[model samples]
Structures are given as C-alpha cells and as structure tokens.
Target: MSLLPDSAVTSAPGLRRAQLLLARQALEAILAAQRPADAILQDLFRDNRQCGSRDRARISELVYGVLRDLRRLQAIAGVQADAGALCALRLLDQGLADAATLEAWGLTASTALARRLAGFDPATLTPAQRDNLPQACHERLVAQYGEDATAALAQALRGQAQVDLRVNRLKATREAARQRLAQEGVKAEPTPRSPLGLRLSARAPLQNLASFREGWVEPQDEGSQLIALLVGARPGDTVVDYCAGAGGKTLALAAQMQDRGELLACDISAARLKKLRPRLQRAGVNSVVGLALPDETALAKFAGRCDAVLVDAPCSATGTWRRNPELRLREPDFAALQALQLRILGDAARLPRAGGRLVYATCSLMAVENDEVVRAFLEQHPEYVREDAGEILRAAGADWQEPELRLLPQRHGTDGFYAVAFRRQGE
Candidate 1:
C-alpha cells in the first residue's frame, strides 16, 4: 500500500480512508510477527511520521479494540477470521465501516473472503480453541492475536480502560492534585482504599498537563499504590525496596516516610535506576539511597539492617493485562519466574532485621508467584510468619485485604496483583 501524506488526508473522507488503511497495515504486521499490540502501535507511529498524533491514537484504539474482542467478533461474523480480516470484522461490528470502508482500504468485500469465513462454524470451535488455538496455530494466531483465549477475554474486550494515577504525596495531597488537574481541564476522582490514588474518567495525555509536569501526580495503577501502602514505611524506620525498578513504589515509600527515614532502593539493573533519578527529583524525594546490585555482594552490604523490605519481584505481569492486554499472549511459564522469585525472596529476607516486616509483591495473578512463593519461603525459614495484609491495611486506616490482595480487572477495576506480607521472629 502506498503511504499517503498527512496533507492528502486532511479531508474527512481522506482521513477515514487513511485510518482504515493504517489499521489494516498495523494488523497485518502484528499477525506477521506476533508483535505486542502496544509495540505494533508504536511501530506504526514511528514508521508513519506523516500521521498526526490524533490519527495515530485513533488507529491504535481501533486496532486494540479489535484485538481485545476478536473472539466475540469472530463469533458474530461466524467464520475462521485471520488478524487482517478481524480488523475488517471489528470495523463492521462497531458500525465504523461499511461497503465503502473495505473498498477504500483496497479490499474488496469479496465473495471468496466471505465464503472462507463462512465455512467455519465459530460455535463449533471449543472454548479454548476459540480463545487460544492449538500451539502450532497459536503462534500464527498470536502473531495475528489468537492467544487471547482466557475466560477473562470477554470482559477485557467489552470495556474501555480508565487512566489511574497515584498522587505524589511528597509534592501534593490527592485533593490538591485533583484540584490542580481540574484547573488544567482534567477530571479526576479519588480511588477508594488508596490514599494517594486518583482515577481519570477519560484518558488524557498526562505529560502535557501542568499537574503532571509539576510533579503533582504520577501515573500509577491503584493496586500498585496499595502495594506501596502495604509497605507502611514509618518515619525514622529504615526500609529497603528490593527490585526497585525505576522506583515507582520506591518514591511512594519515600513519601510515606515523610522523607525522614532512610530508604535503600536496590535493583539489579543500573539502566532502570538511572531512569529513577529524574523521577526522584520530580517527586522531591531525597530519603531514598539508590543502590545498584550487580551480585549478592552488593546485597550483603546492608544485610539485616532494614526495618521493612519490599520485594516487588518480577513475574509474567498477568495482573496488568487491562493496561497491556498483550501480556495474555505470553506463554504461561512459571519456571523462569519461580527461579527469579526464589532468588529475590531469599535476598530480600536477608536484608530485613529481626522482627522486620517483609512484603512480597508481584503484578501477577498466579498462585505460584503469590501464595506459593510465600509458602515456600516460610517453609525454608521457620523464623518468619505470614502477616495478615488486610488487617495490616485496616489497622493503618486503609481498607484492603489479606489472604489474597488479588485485584481482577472485572472485580476491582484495577490490575490483577498479588501481595503478601511476612514478619521475622523477634530479636
């Protein structure tokens, strides 16, 4: 397809045609390589420098909407739909496309295409098959968006996700941040249970907002904000943020300490820590002492000195599928995550002093990463005991949960997260 110049698509008719064409091309690339939807959209923006920001945003929304609801759309279309074909089907489903849209995209709503699609009975396909095709075809479909077969797919496809932000308490209160954003023509409502969270009804480009630029707010999920609250860093106490990648929660911890306590923020990646530097400055956080740990020797320096240790271990990020549905495409493999969690939990446990609290957190919905990891760690170290996270939050005047702080998109309107807290034996 020939790339059209922005000026050529200045008219309404021309813009709609360009959007359809771009959506088709982006879907084809996704199907061809199994690229993540976000990555595909980014590549589309990069490749089509002529496309304006509005055009890119519109195309991305349409593409992702179709990907999110491909299964249901295929059911409605009643055919074995490929990725490129799914884009057309979605346009039809949304009433965004008519006979003209297909033709404009250089596609003939051909009899042959219809016949091929009509041949397969979407009803006949097994639920799993409908959600995620066989492994052989999985890659192709995933390349085309076939991996979204989970039971939660329907929910994810039906709704538009809201923007969540955590108020930077170090810079401003949630009410103050809300007021600041309101003056800038953005609407925000406080999130329940998270003292520092605000939910945006409409998604706005936050970086352009004066409130965001002035460090009054930080883009963070409500569940993530709660995770930091669970850490409960107190003034004069020493805390450690193990696996503090880019220090999102680390800064929150610093804020909770009122910038009075010492916070040792440790991460394996120096590159990620470097990124946190600017954020620290923006949040006016000074209590955090950044530490790059290349190996265990680095972790050894501050062993048994921390009062509270937060191990936000890495996982498959199953919890964040609402924000990035592409993660559902990832193969459900616990082996690598299990190994990494073991190392992180072990290292994190060593960092806390006797009687210190250890909070293990993951943006993962899996049992293996949340409950099982904690169970295993407790078994190995008899001196540690699981604390009731829900009770702890309640005692802190925040309403949350223990057993499982699992936040499902359908249930909590937040990312799926699993957090558990533990306390060591008294000195």
Candidate 2:
C-alpha cells in the first residue's frame, strides 16, 4: 500500500524539506486532477510512509490552505502559479515562512508578489476571486441567490467544517456513545439540531476507536442526519433510498425504521452498492436490500408499493464547499446536471405509493439543482403535493420552520442542504 520506496523515507534533519516537497506534489496533483484534496493526500501519504505525524500535519495544512483561498493566491503569485509558488505565498500570508524559507525551498519572492500579498485588499479582488469561486460558479450563485446572499454563502464555504457523527440507535444511545468516545479521549457534544447527532471538538483517529469499530457511531453531517429524520420512516414501512451511494442515508433510514422495515438501497453503480455491505453488517442493520439499477423490470416491481422514497440526487455539491474546496476551482455544467436531476426525480417519484411520502434532497445551494428541479418535477407530476419540510422536521425536534428546509454552513453551522418533501395526492 506504500506508494514510495524505502529510500524516500527520511529522518528528522530533512523532514521539513520533505514535508514541503510532499505538499507541493500533492497540491499540484489536486489542482491538475481537480479531485478531492483529502483523497489525493491520503494516496500521497500512503506512498510515503516515512512521513511522520508532523510531516502529514504540515503537508495537509499547506495543501488545504492553498485550496481554500486559491484565487486570491493566484492573483498575487500569478495566474499560472505553480504549486511551490502558491505554497510559499500561503506560508508568507500566514506568517509561517519568510524570504529565507522560500529561498531554501528553491523559490523566489519578488518584491511585487510580497507587496501584493501583504497589502492585499478585498476591494482589489474581482467578485469571483473575492468569493474564491470560478467565474461561472460565481455568476450562477449570483443569479440564484443574488449578490449579497451569494457573498455570505461564499464566505461560509471558505471556512473549515467540523466533524459530526450520527449515533447508530441500533447499537447505542447518543449519551452512551458520547461516554464511550470520551473514554477513548474523543470529545464531542450533542449537536444543536438533530437529536441523534454529535459535534466533535477536534478530529481524532476515529477509525481506531472502539466506538467506531463497533459501529456505535458513524460520521455524518448534522444536516444529513436531519434529512434522514425528515423522511419519517417508521417500523414495518417499506422505504426506498433511490440513489443510495454507499448507503449513508439508507443506514440512517434503517435506524429510523427501528430495523423492522423493508429498506431498498438502489444505485446505478454496483461497485458503490457493494461498499454498503460491510457497513450494513457493522451497523447491525438487517432490513436493507441493496440493488444495483438498470434492472428496470426489477425496480418497476416496487412501484406504488413503498411508503416512502428518498431521492438524494447527485448535484454540483456547491453547498459542501466548506469541506470540499477543490470544487470551487472547477466549472460544473448546470444545464446537463439540471436535466439529469429532473429525470432522476421523475424516476424516484414512481416508487412511492398513493398517499406515500417522497423527500427530494441535495447537498447543493444552487436553485437550478435544488428548488428549480423540484418545482420542475411538480409541474410534470401534479399528483405530488409539496409539503412543509420544516414542519415535519420541527415535529421531530428541529428548529427550522420554512416551507423548504435549507441548511447553510454560515447560519446553521452545518453543510448546505436543501430538502423538500411531497406526498402523493391520492390513496
């Protein structure tokens, strides 16, 4: 599993240079591939086993810092700045490095670059660059949320995300899980909203913890936990997670149903569905049936039979920018994404029986992918009536009260999420 050979692992003397070098390489790969920074760095660290804890800490900070404020760094460093240059600029801005440090890393700090970085003004930045968003994404946000709201959302997205966990009710109560995690030196407090959620004060090696290993808790966003709660699936009901990639929501739904319902987890990718098997076993869930789609005849059999259906459709993931900053650099094709979302909603709509509930949700802030998609679906399927998501969630103990539930990182301290529930008109 190690990516690097034995020769590359260095002792303490060259550790600083090694860390910088690794950070540069990792950042370059992330920028070029436009992949998740977390995944890319996991691969990089795996290859270089010689990297100590400190080395990994430094590397991750540099890589994520550069990505979090990339456009501004690009403005000061250069539009085509290399990873090394960006890293140097980031260090300089944070007061983590100086001229000598850059020189030691074989990098140059021009007077202009230094001046611009030190005296950088928000007034000087273009709206897009100020928001750290690609031009297309900026324009889209402005069109959907207006300039002022978009800027606030952008500011929220630039901040870091806290780790949240959803206690597996099947395995333990929230208080019991908290106590067990604390015994293992992990500090967490109950989340403000979701009854089953906990917010960790800092990241810990949760995978090695007995609580996680035994599935007493699973990492999930509070907003995501709220979405599962909104589904309102009960024991003995038949529910379907229509686009269940890796079964996060499916698992949560099973817990909601008290592991006594018929829960169908369906996804187009069999490989993705395969991942849910181990998770299901670990969570001690027995009600789930994983299905890989394109089995039209098979899925059709469930039509008008399920009590509830959840369409956590794929989207541009703009609401998740706080955790996945790399997405800010890429331009998503909104037209195509909209069309696909609408189509998926239509397909999922058929699964809920008459008078059954359907909740369409996305981790997206864009109207085209959130409200627009749902409204479009309503226009096509008049038999489905939109319900107040806030009312449903409030009865379940959430503070929200809007017609459609929109969770924003800035306002709610959670990932940006949108959910709208609907009920079939006839019984």
Candidate 3:
C-alpha cells in the first residue's frame, strides 16, 4: 500500500487502498467543515481534474455510502476512532474488502475500528444504528407514521435514490424522451405514477446527453413532478409559484400550461431566481416571469389573481435524505421551521382567486411540516377547502389511489414528498 514512487505498489488492491484513504480524508473535511458533501466532493473533483471518471464515481460512492451510515459506523468504530477508522469499518461491513485485504491496507492503524465492527452484532444495535437514523428521528417517525410504518420509512430512506427526469413536453413527448434517452446510451422507462416522468435504469451523466442539452429533458424526482401536477395549472390561467427556488416547478407548470398562461416564479433569494432565466430559456418556457420577493408591490399585483398557486415551502428536507445524505447528520429546528412554513403558507395562500386552487407542498416526510402546517393554515383561512388529493391524481392520469399523497423513497422509489391541494372558496 506504499504511495511513495520508490516503493509504490501499482497493483489494483494497492490503488484501492490509496483511494479509500483519500475518500476518508475528504469525509473528515466534510464533517469537520460542516459543509455539504456534494459541494465538497465537487471541489475535490475540480481541484483534481486529472482524476478519471471511474475514479470520481468510485470516490463519490464511497463518500456517500459512509455518510449515509455514519451513525452506525461511528457506533461500531467507537467514540475515540477517527474518520479513517470509520471509512475502514464501512468498507469492511459492506464486504467491499476482506479482512486480509484490509490488513494489508492499514489494519494495524485501524485495529480499534476493525475490532469493534467485527465484534458488533448488527441485530443487537438499536433501530437508529441498524437503519443509520438519528436517535432523535425515531420518536418523531413513530409520532408521524406510528411504529411499524416508521421502521419501513427509515429503511427506505437508507437506500440510494433513483435517477428520475421530467420530460419537457414542450420539446418532446414522454415516449419521444424515452426513445431519445435510449439512443443516447441511457436506458429509461416511464414512471408509473407520473406520465411525464422517466426513471433511468442507473445514474448517468445527464449533461452529456443531447436530450438534456436540447431541453427535451430536465432531471427531477417523480414526487416533485407530482407536486406540480397537484397544482393543476392549466392553459389560459394565471399561476404563481411562490417560493419557487430556481423554478423547477415553475418550468413544469409552464409546460402544463402549454406555454400559454402567465406564470410568475417568485423566490426570496435573487441569486436563486437569477438561475431560473437560463433554465426557462433552455426549457423553452415562454410563459414564466421570474421575480425576487420582498417586493411588496410585485407580490401585491398577483394577490387574489392567480388561478393556481403553489407554496413549495422550505422545511427540514428529510425527504431528500437519500440524495443528500449529509443532511442526516444535522439536527433540525422544528419549531422555527414550522413557524416559517406557516408564514409562507399564509403569504402564498393569498394569491389564489375564489374557486382557484392553492397547493402546499414539502419535500419532507414529517407530519408537523406537512399536515400540521396545513391544518393550522386552514383554521386561520376558512376561505380555503382541502381537495381530494387522490381524485386530483386520478384526473391527472396517475394510477395512484389514496385520499392523501405521501410519496416515500422506499414505497414510490422517489424522493419523499407530501402535498395537499386546496381550492379557495368564495366568501
């Protein structure tokens, strides 16, 4: 495993050892700096541009795998162990390396990690350890989904997320998009619940595909696509995507409108809203107008005028844990987040005209952020009435049939999302 040129072991196992060490170093930086794993990885790749594609992918997989199960790895590696021991423990537990191979790699240096993980019985570990969930998360899961379903949801989130794309029908139909992806060396199939959604067989370099660059496809989770569908924006109607960060749903709504309606994409961050212009242009979305928020006059103009309003409120983002495993390490301020969610709901709830629909959506699995917020908002604003979510899904041609829509990673193979639609009644 010598890295020095004079004693360099160029064998595959030696290279593998070197790579794992590097990954562990990066993981240490991620935890120490408290930075997003994806951002840190991007920076690492950017600085070491000489690394091949395979090397980058392998490194990313190793890093994310460890991050996903950091809690379990830590419990096994002991509180005294460093990041290197944690990585070693994860690789061994995953059976990525045999004891003999690990010994050659650095077993002496990682004795504590190896001893702890080897002696540790996975079944004896608590649910938090077995499922790599925070101990705090278990109680909340029970409160949200009861005991049985909570375990199921936790296990589902422990798996990797599927790569999903939204077919921009403005440029190509779902069938055409599927065919185009196939021709580009990427195999894809239509998502069962989203007519315009395509699930890739494996994650591929999307930017390299012609369909993506040509605006025929945009990478999006099926759950997110469903949230846009819940909005039910239509042609000749004015729609508002309040809090549309970078306007992913805004683009979808424009396509649903056949690019024939007024669609305002608003966000508090000007920097994020600025990104929407290029995406809108690329998607051939002609009906979207991006607006930075806190502009009293701007928001007032759309008040009580939109046929549809989508409040894609911010939350803990626990639903996206599969894709962003780093978030699993942080604790959420539930009280502050819920208060903010209610304020945003109240603000966005004003845009829907009488008889018009306002959809509240969150990429969160927590009931406090989804149902509780909706209930509070409904109580405050009696002018709005909740709509049948399953009825809307059926009308949108989705095969789903539940009174409420809660797409989970394990259940639906999509990012966890909770959406409830309501039509503002005339007072």
Q: Which model scores highest in lDDT?
A: 2
**Candidate 1 TM-score, C-alpha based:** 0.85
Q: Rate the local accuracy (lDDT) of all candidates.
A: 0.73, 0.87, 0.83
Clashing pairs in 1: 31-143, 34-143, 131-149, 141-146
lDDT of 2 by residue, 1-427 (tens): 2224435533322226667778999989998996688999999988988877777887888888898999989988766488988887887777666656566556665334567687877687899998899898899889987899888988989988999999999999999999999999999999998999999999988879989989899999999999998998999999999999978899999998989979999999999999999889899998899889878888888999989999999999988988999887878889999999999999989999998999999998888898888879999999999988888888877667787888988889999999999999895
**How many clashes in candidate 1?**
4
TM-scores, each model vs. reference:
0.85, 0.93, 0.93
- At residue 341, candidate 3 shows an lDDT of 98
Ranking by lDDT: 2, 3, 1
lDDT-superior candidate, 1 or 2: 2
In candidate 3, what are the lDDT values of residues 1-427, reduced to their tens digit?
Answer: 1223323443323236656766877888888886788889888878867666766776788889888888777777666557777777777777676555566776555555666777887777787777777777777888777878888888788788889899998999999999988999999999989988999999899889889998999988999998898888789999999889978899999999999979998898999988888888889988888888888898898889889999999998999988888888877878899999999899888888999999989998888898899899999999999999888887887777887788888778889999999999994
Error in Å for residue 37 of model 3: 1.4
Q: Report the lDDT tens digits of candidate 1 across residue range 1-427.
A: 3345545543233346677778878877765675677788887788888777767877887777776665555554554466656766666555555545465566665233444444656677665445532233234324432345344543552466678898887788789889988988899998887878899978889889988877788888888888888887898889989889979899888888988978988888888888998888888888888888766676677688888999999997766655665555446567778888978798678878898999999987666677678888988888899888888777656667555466667667787788888888879
